[model samples]
Target: MSEEPLEQLDAVDFAVIAFHVDGEWDVDELTLDHLLDAPTLVAAMRRLPGEDSVALVAVDEDWFLVARVVEGRVRMLLSDATAAEDWDLAASVLDLLGLPEPEDDDDQVPAGDLGLLADLGMGAEDLGALIADLDLYPEEILSEVAEEIGFGDDFDDVVGLAPADHA
Candidate 1:
């Protein structure tokens, strides 16, 4: 791990809270003082008025996190396991999942449950492949995920991403 503290490395590009209601998806931006804190993020997700809620976060354009709370159970996915070294959110996620902190030379792979969004149409295989694609930025990967889970437009609107051309 680098000598720099997590406070210096943690940079959240955006955080979005999403949930399904009345057959439609509701997406809203979330502002957190400690965006990299897994407990804080999960607690916020759990407080939403829904049976299930999801938080999609992009950090420093280098990694992404998907946290889902279902019936009081929490599931999370971190795009790059190695990010744990530099970000408290990633480290805390590994801690929550009972994963060891990644070593300096560890492969930059994903950690946590890829199936966290399985029931929402983004299965483990699809998510794994998406994160593995190094060509995409964290926000792009999350945008694709939102599309798969039926909230692409809502996510784009909340995050100020230009709408995709439908024509």
Candidate 2:
């Protein structure tokens, strides 16, 4: 199968959510100008006024970033090991995680700490395996991941992804 550059997906496909499961989940449609680096993203998430705030970001069908902040501490995971070289948001994620760009262009590995949310249901390996499933679009995969973590319908609604399509 031929692949389109992930940069193209950033147009309408990139989105981020700052959520507190019991409270609110705010969505942001990411554009090239607002592709904030990790620290900035986390700081914004911090202002969400919840003890259990998490930032979930998906860039097309190629990458996902999950960041959680608790008691002033931050934990995060940036998936799609290969997107760092192709997507600006992914590269910014690498900077936030303090990881270097990939030396090779295979784009098939999990770049940052995958185990970051292992206890929350979707671990690194699970995410890696999900990404390998080329049959699913980013919305479908994100829907599954969100459901695993207890926000299936909310995420789909916020992202405007029809349940019928993913089903």
Candidate 3:
């Protein structure tokens, strides 16, 4: 048994939040058992207080995952499918998507629901391009996504990444 929790975002000031429509989002922190399979993820999302919720799971500093629940349909997006080989959350997400485990070290395949944020601001092609850009960190990409989706500053505050509040 590993001492580290299965879902802790390893990067500094970066977190996975369950974004809600009503502005009441929460960090998506789950137990290892809860992340082992999809059913538990569905259960966890169902238990959330939001009418619409999405699991914005961070995959280290390099990538992230966004899983949304709407009308009982779970749509997911892995920021960098390559992270699947390294992160437990990404691998579990591939399981949920019914995709085979990623094996190729050179295969930087970005998989799952690419249109998860189509209605918000970014479409599949747009997100795919962003994920392919190796220069940006997951937090940088997510910050842009948050801004596009209308929660830029709030999200920064949630993750304590807000510019230092010098008084």
Candidate 4:
């Protein structure tokens, strides 16, 4: 069957969200209620300062995934790093959301500047789709990254990975 058109996707059901994220940064396994605890996720999506929102997808209570969306795609979002805890709540959320695992072999691969971004993709279209699939709010993190880079411009082209600083 052809993929469902984005427009046709009704508002995501949030009754019992199975939010998920994928990547090394994930902190621990979590439930929908738990992910909701992170107010930043919601605030970023709404583009409101200090405002928070919750995932709208519904899921089985027994298990589900939760995560953050970066650059428009679902990535296993992390709260922070914990050395001893094997149960990563963020990773568990990514799994529930059906997000793919980030390639763990980044260290083995050679990288130049923006190597991490390159892993996301060399083209804007590919990256944009990936970002949209992400569970984490793209605007907030990207804005933060841009500001840190000293660009001080807004990255309007997540599709183009445009260097931005207007955030």
Candidate 3 global lDDT: 0.65
In model 3, what lDDT does residue 132 have? 80
Number of clashes in every candidate structure?
1, 1, 0, 47
Question: For residue 105, what is the lDDT in candidate 1?
Answer: 41
Query: Over the stretch 1-167, how does candidate 2's per-residue lDDT look in tens digits?
Result: 12343344444364656455455554454443334467767777677665766566776655677777766777876666567776666777778778788887775666666665576677777877776787866667777777776566767777787763432
Clashes of 1: 1
Top candidate when judged by TM-score against the true structure: 1
Predictions ranked by TM-score, top down? 1, 3, 2, 4
Pairs clashing in candidate 3?
none
Output the TM-score of candidate 1: 0.89
RMSD of each: 3.2, 5.3, 4.4, 16.4
lDDT of each: 0.83, 0.65, 0.65, 0.30
**Candidate 4 lDDT, 1-167, residue by residue in tens:** 12332221222222222112342121111233333323434334344222221132222211122233434443333322220022233334434445444455222211112222333322334333333443534433343333333221422332133554332
| Global Cα lDDT for candidate 2 | 0.65
Which is superior by TM-score, 3 or 4? 3
Point out where model 4 deviates above 4 Å. 1-33, 36-87, 99-103, 107-141, 144-164
Model 1, residue 160: C-alpha shift (Å) = 0.8
